[model samples]
Target chain A: MDLLEYQGKQLFARHGVPVPRGGYAATVDEAVDVADGLGYPVVVKAQVQIGGRGKAGGIKIAQDRDECRAHAEAILGMDIRGLTVRELWIEEASDIASEYYASFVFDRAAKATLAMLSTKGGMDIEAVAEEDPSAIARLHIDPLLGFQDYHARRLCFEAGVDADVVRPVSALLAKLYEAYVAEEAMLVEVNPLIIKQDRSVAALDAKVTLDDNALFRHPENAELRNPSAEDPQEQMAKERGLTYVKLDGDIGILGNGAGLVMSTLDVVAQAGGRPANFLDAGGGSKAEAITSAVEVILSDPKVKAVLFNIFGGITRCDEVARGLITAFEQIKPQVPFVVRLDGTNDQEGRQLLADANLPNVHTAATMDEAASKVVEVARA
Target chain B: MSILVDKDTRLCVSGITGREGTFHTLNNKRYGTNVVAGVTPGKEGQDVDGIPVYNTFRKAVDEHGANTAMIFVPPRFAADSILEAADAGIKLIVAITEGIPAHDELRVYTHLKRLGDVRLVGPNCPGILSPGKANVGIIPAAFFKEGNVGVVSRSGTLTYQIGNELAQRGFGNSSIVGIGGDPVPGSSFIDIIELFENDPQTELIVMSGEIGGSAEEEAAEYIAANVSKPVVGYIAGFTAPPGKTMGHAGAIVSGSQGTAAAKAEALESKGVRVGRTPTQVADIAVEILGG
Candidate 1:
């Protein structure tokens, strides 16, 4: 789950990472009140789950009450990269000396945590990575050994952080690492970790993405989940305990495994159809799970047709066939259904579907055939 | 001989008393895998289908001469289970549980790599199998046929899909290994591919990947530098949006990287035939093997 800037900072503060004093506001009046409490020259930043807020005018510094209200009014309800600013984080402005980048991302290839610190900060880090690769200092901390004081020291030294501020920067990096492990964050990033006039380091921005799989251990992070940015179909699916991702297009994809569902989407597209969503009933899926998956798929009005691709391993094809029949009974779906059953109990599953022979239900023999059939039906 | 599991693999089950553990254990045993013993911490002296249950993995290893371990523990305890299997001197560990926290996994990964002798495959995967020889984990055993194409994939059903496709086309597998599609697999593409390359029976390889990470790109490099066998590669999630985890924790695209196009291109450039679909992947493999 991606935390907003305000939430990220709050999380960082709990780990002893220095963040500029900030107050959250939900309205223009609240923004003015927050600025009033924080004194003059507050940075009015929009709270969204995405980046590039400054370029989109979602961030502004207000010197006084009038400017604060103006900036808040301009940003509130404004769409920045398709996400509206519903809330504001008003932080006391700092006298900046320099900006540097720092982050910890779970590196999949190395099977370790990668810590990156660079003199380049605040702007697009990807651009910096492409343009000047050597500008960033990179280190992979073995999760077994963890982030050490010397590791931080080496990283800051390699990044050429100002000698006067390296100690503070190193301290902040250590704290960030703690937040990453303690919070189970997939990504902990601070673009433009600012060095102040007093040579103290503070996080000017926080972009923390907590791993959803680890959320069971950290219940406090549940409240940090921003459902406002979520697609309604995805949210509905989540509530039903289904792994679903919303996408554009008309064909609804339902399958047993992640890779197979994703492959179904690609195949549907390759067969000249657009997929509406990706829904996996998971391994060992039964009839009820299939019903829920189908319900989730048809929940989107845009889905003109639904495809059920079942390559049953632990997931029985008979169970999937039963699911489609149950979904038909409950949902009364108007759109066409293309069902492909393979693997365990597939014959019984196909027989069950054939016996039911519900309206608009087409049985396919292969994934390629299933994709083509669903796309054709949806297009028709 | 097939890579990983074969007729010689004497197996022990971790978390053997749990519902999934018990069910799949009996299922695997029924499929001709050599089931020796099980470990459930406190379930010592208990038996599932007459298979002995020991409290410690060490006892299973010592008493039964078990060399392979299959994990069915819950996500929270799955990592520790893996470490224990390694500590007990199991040569290969196959973890079938999913949703293991990333933090726990990295530590397990580090520990295993440092140990250097033991092999770990999938905390969220369907285990490896050599057709007509041995079967491990939850992959339905009915779909496979004994042949020379070794299948290694990051997904369970997708592997089955292509495996089924191959079987339908008069081809069969030397061994099919499901490494899983998590952010950090206990085993990687390179790890399994190395085994496949060395095995005398594995005449060709089919690699399945999706839209995530540099594992596929790195594996392409390894296949190029090593392996003389013809390779057919398939990647999923061409339509997956950036920054959205499709279903797997690792299958997300971030900032113009880890795309299906990129992974496919990497493999293609390495002289690996890239198939866009499961059927196409099987077809490509057959074409190369036939030639």
Candidate 2:
């Protein structure tokens, strides 16, 4: 889960990483008050979970209370990359001598954590990676041995930071790494780690993505989830313990596994239908769970047809079929449903669905046929 | 011989008293897999489908001589279960549990890799199965048949989907491995590809991949340099939107990275027949194996 800038900074500060003094505000008055309290020249940044906030006019520097209020008012309702800025982070502006980038992310290729440091900051790191790869010094930390001081020293030296800021930067890097591992973060990024005039280093921006799977260990972090950022259907599905992503198409997809759900989306497109959402019923989903999933899908009025494409492994098709039947009884959904059952107890499952023979309920023998059927029915 | 599992694989089911563990254990045994023991802490001395249950993986390994461990523990304990299996000296560990924390996976992955001997297939996977020989994890055993086409994938149902498609077309699999769809999965395409390349019975390989990460691209490079077997590949999530986690945690496209188009291109450039659909993947496998 992506943390808002304020939330990320809070996490960083908790780990002894120095961050610019900031106050989170949800209103214009609060923003002005925060700027007043911070003694002016504050950065009124939109607290959205997307990148390129500045390019999108979601970030503004205000030297006075009027400017702070105006910027807050302008950015609060503004939509940056489809995410509305409901909150504002009012941070004291730092005096920057130089800018550098530092981030610790999971290097999937190496199956290890890598700390990336670069002198070229305040820009897209991907661009730096493509254009000037050598500017970024990557340090892969072995999970067993962990981040040592030497590793941080090497990162600082290789990134070519000024000697005056080297000790501070190295110290900050260690703290950042500590926050990363402690927070169970998939990514802890501080782009433009600004070196102040006093030669002390501080994180100017924070983009932290905590591993959702590890949220159980960090309940406080889990509570940081903002429901406003998520689609209502997705939020409801999450509450129901179902994996769901809202899309723009009309065919609602429900499947047993992630890969199958993804392939179902592809097949639906292949069969000339646009999928409205990706919903994984997950492994071992029962009738009640299936019913909840159907209810969630039906909640989206754009969904013209619901497709149940299940390949039962540990998940029995009969159990899923039972769930679908139970859902039909509870929901009485108006949209058509295309059911494709395979794997364990598929015959009995198919028989159950066939016996129900509810109106607008269609069954196909294969995934391709199911997709074609759903698309055809949805279009009709 | 199959790549990972064969007739000689003595399986032990961890979390055996649990719902999924018990169910798949019976399924694997019914498929003729020699599930010699079961492991569930505090449920020792019990029996699951006539398979002896032990409190620790160590007992399963010590008493039953179980060489393979199939994990069905809950997500929270999955990493510990994997570590336990490795510590107990299980040569091949297949984790069927899903939702394991990424940090825990990293710890288990780092620990397992350092051991240099233990092999892990999945933590959110459908495990590996050699048809007519042995089965592990939650894959439905009925969909498989004994043949020479080795299957490895990052998905559960998609593997079964293609495996079933191939089986219907008279192309049976030598073994099918689900390496899982997490961002930091224990095994990779290269790991299984290397095993398939060296397996004597494996004539060809069918690799199933999806978006997210460069594992497929890297696997394509390995196939080009080392693998002599004909490879047919299918990458899902062509229609997936960028930045959406398309069901799989690792199956998201960030910027230009982890796109199905890129993976398909990489595989095609390496002489592997890349298919746009599951049936096309199966068709290519049949055409290569049948011809």
Candidate 2 lDDT over residue span A188-233, tens digit each: 9999899989888899999998888889999999899663487899
User: For candidate 1, lDDT tens digit of each residue in A146-207?
Assistant: 89999999999999998988899999999999999999999999998999999998999999
Off by over 4 Å in 1: none
Name the lDDT value of residue B30 in candidate 2: 88
Best by DockQ: 1
Would you list the clashing residue pairs of candidate 1? none
Interface Cα root-mean-square deviation for all models: 0.9, 1.3
Clashes of each: 0, 0
Candidate 2 reference-contact recovery: 0.86
Clashes by residue pair, model 2:
none
The CAPRI category of model 2 is medium
